[model samples]
Target: MSLLASGSLLAQGSESKEKEMEAAWQAAQSSAQAGPATVKLGEQATLKLPAKEVFIPQPAAGKLMHAMGNLDDERLLGLVLPTGDDDWMVVAKYEPSGYIRDDEAKDWNVDDLFKSLKEGTEAANEEREKRGISGLEIVGWVERPHYEAASHRLVWSMSAREKGQPADAPQSVNYNTYALGREGYVSLNLITARDQVDANKPVVRTLLSNLDFTEGKAYADFNASTDKVAEYGLAALIGGVAAKKLGLLAILAAFFAKFAKVIALAVAGIGYSATKWFRRKPSGSAEPK
Candidate 1:
């Protein structure tokens, strides 16, 4: 072969090899970053690197703002939130399934769970109205199942607006809800104002792009350790046993001391009701013999 032709062929071969290597590298990085797909509620999928990472249900609003600063990427999913002026945006990463598989216990159907959530939303709206506030306006809701060879994961999402004045009409708010192990995690994001697109769009995009289907590491960082019902029940049982052995007043006093605020509120409410009842009755009226 001629010298020129040989050189050209060698260059082409080198370029092809380079391209293949790059593609392989990208695949490896993606796999490494997205560890496993299955996680229970309250579990988190963390990134390999520790650079400026923020967990869902991040500690402070200011921290979230800082983590999202100056990020510009468009391929990410934008979760919009409601604001008085314009909608705010947040990006989501994980899609979870809602199916629960328990052979001994009753299994919850995905469709039924969704129906229950819808009912809850309606009830929330009614409660708002009772508080003399405008009702909630929901934009959309998303539910998807994450599947693996052996099991499935459930995820839920909803977007809605809270009460606002007529002049300050409701805007959008995006909610991303999912279960990791047995714990639930929710990520919220606010949409940007119309005029502030330049400042907010890039942040929204970057957040979405960084989000993927890999197992999330953020869940471990923030969930409460014990289940409230189980913990409280155990405490009550122990206390009851001790009270039976000792004296009821000591046990009752301990309980009241532990839940002073709750008891105080209940007492106050009862006192107010009694006072109203007594005031409504006629002072001169005899007992209904």
Candidate 2:
């Protein structure tokens, strides 16, 4: 009877997992957009989200939560780039609600935002702890926020280290960039380890500049009388708004997957010894080389 019960439980677990994969696959296909073409950014502009380089433009955002297996609330995301090469992926979405004012960019303070982000990370760690996972800490920024008035572009990056990770241990970064439009903006995030950011930076910047904002939808087209302006400005966009966590962390889970081994040791409550046990031998180990 005990054996039968165990078998039944296993069957249920398998069925549940199968359903999840099917659901993820279907969702991914539903929102998937092929590249080398123009995709309207909610009436504000056109995005030439290319799919070459193993990049799949506008992939199903659900796959990032399910198939990728880590997240913090990515419901706002409308598009994703699943780069088959390495564990890197890019997420982009357009918020067309209104225009984001950049006047505050002139005196933006990094020290304040850094402090706010650390506090925000501490709060996020609480949730991680409840899930029997190791927590995280906001060490510092890999790149402080910078805004270019000419192009109406903003760029910044932050680094996070696992709780108890050695001081010299490697960290991950979310290199974020944004292009402001008359209606809203398009944020493109390159989720990767700190070491990989330099290599990936150029490509992502190119991607940002190539995104075409249609005429009358460009930042210069803002009509003060008729256009709605965002309640907050650039400073609020970079730092937390109202002391709440920056929505950026939601997608930072993409970095967690990139460093899966570190995540196993850091977040999953797993130790190094378990790795050896799970390691598989080469299929031809018994044969002569």
Candidate 3:
């Protein structure tokens, strides 16, 4: 074949591979919510993997880490999985933090916590720079730390943009909630475009409600008499301790990009880059009717 013809064929082949990868990614996501499954979340809790939603149990979580990228987390239980049912969907992850105390919740101030997060993230950026990763700037609270003392559940989010991105650039946020048990807490991480938190919250709420603490492991069973309490309190989970892990949360972006054939379909589905999925007027929380 002529040199010109050979180049054209190579270009066509590259395009074909790209299209194939996209299709495979879509098919994997569509299969997520296909078969219902149950994953035992440690000895304390259980997750109900509803129909059509994929659930990666802890055993296979390593497979994901391999496919996605290096996630610098040690407490990772597993990802709750995302369904390709919407333009964008929230990816929830579970991490078990054994028996944290809520005592500090009373004395904690939201402003102080915010300051710590800012300080901690700014400090983390130094390390990120050393590693050649882009710095992340905290844009402020999407949802301030809200702890439900009664249920032992906490929900909070921070708006973050890649350093130096345009003000209105699409962003990423993690709306985290925890189901505190007698042993440790189970963290539910909802990762998605910062703009789609509202659209994806109902599903998040459902997932939180459905995560059940098995017998002898419910937070109510906390036997101060016999239970082992974590050294950190609820405040640390939000303020200092959390800031470190929050720095690495952006790996989800790298994860999607690395496997642009699978979860990356949100971009094509919405006619935008994967980063800009669910572009809309950003809201701190779901707008009221």
Candidate 4:
């Protein structure tokens, strides 16, 4: 989600705005695919969605993202939300920017990555404030960037708080994971309250593992002679490089300044409907929630 005018919600009138949100949520919930299902991520990959979660496909997912202040991005595949109250949501995106080289991960410096993240976020804050959203500052990494060469996967976590908020104030965390593919990569970013990340880590990791590229789309299947290479390397996904290329918020999407309140609305509107959706399923259905 990019930076949106914080007042955008209020401008629509509280009651009217909420009705729109509820309507969008309802539309999305009605289309959700109950899990223990196979969901194609465009043409690049597929996710083996577990029984404890639900997959909301595009159009509906895109609508929900818009209702929440994000622009309609074609890169968005869908949304992964838990079957129960997990207090987190995953935004899945696929960037077909060609093959990305992971060689930089070997010698990348952690301190430098941290420094670049702080600087990039500080710069992004100026834009956030201009749009009426609270300025955010990185509190430092909750979990440093870790890359798995064999699996071609990357994982990292960071916490942020609204500028001027007290040190003890509740913060938000963006726990990101990427799975590389021949065509490009797929990212699954989990947005949640900072305090809940540790408890929620397993859930996101499971989903990441469940996602697999199709036969010819696997990273190792890249054809050097014919394939295009991404301009940036793996490390770029972390800091300045990504901020410059993809925009900081595009990479982070950490719009959790008011996540608790936003999630409450999500649970009330989407989660409750999802529960009822499962109940509506026939007992003889092949996929049970």
Best by lDDT: 4
lDDT of each: 0.30, 0.60, 0.59, 0.76
**Which portions of model 3 miss their true places by more than 4 Å?**
1-37, 72-74, 87-96, 241-289
C-alpha RMSD of each candidate structure in angstroms: 29.5, 8.2, 9.0, 5.9
Structural similarity to truth (TM-score) of each candidate: 0.29, 0.69, 0.70, 0.84
What is the RMSD, in Å, between candidate 2 and the native fold over all Cα? 8.2
lDDT of 1 at 14: 60
What is the per-residue lDDT of model 1 for residues 13-102, given as tens digits with 9 covering 90 to 100? 666544433332222222222112222212333222122222222222222222222122221222222212232334333323122222
Over 50-149, each residue of candidate 4 has an lDDT whose tens digit, in order, gives 8878888888888777766556788889988776756678888898978999998999898888887777776767666676677788898989999999
Q: Which regions in candidate 4 have their CA more than 4 angstroms from the true location?
A: 1-12, 242-261, 264-289
lDDT, ranked from best to worst: 4, 2, 3, 1
**Residue 81 alpha-carbon offset, candidate 3, angstroms:** 3.3
Superposed Cα deviation of residue 66, candidate 2 (Å): 3.8
Lowest summed lDDT across 10 adjacent residues in model 3 is found at 254-263
Which of the two candidates, 1 or 3, achieves a greater lDDT against the reference? 3
Model 4: lDDT equals 0.76
Which candidate, 1 or 4, would have the higher TM-score against the true structure?
A: 4
Summarize candidate 3's per-residue lDDT along 55-109 as a digit string, tens digits: 5444344444333333444555655544444533334444455678888788878
Specify the poorest-scoring 10-residue window by lDDT in model 2: 272-281
lDDT of 2 at 183: 86
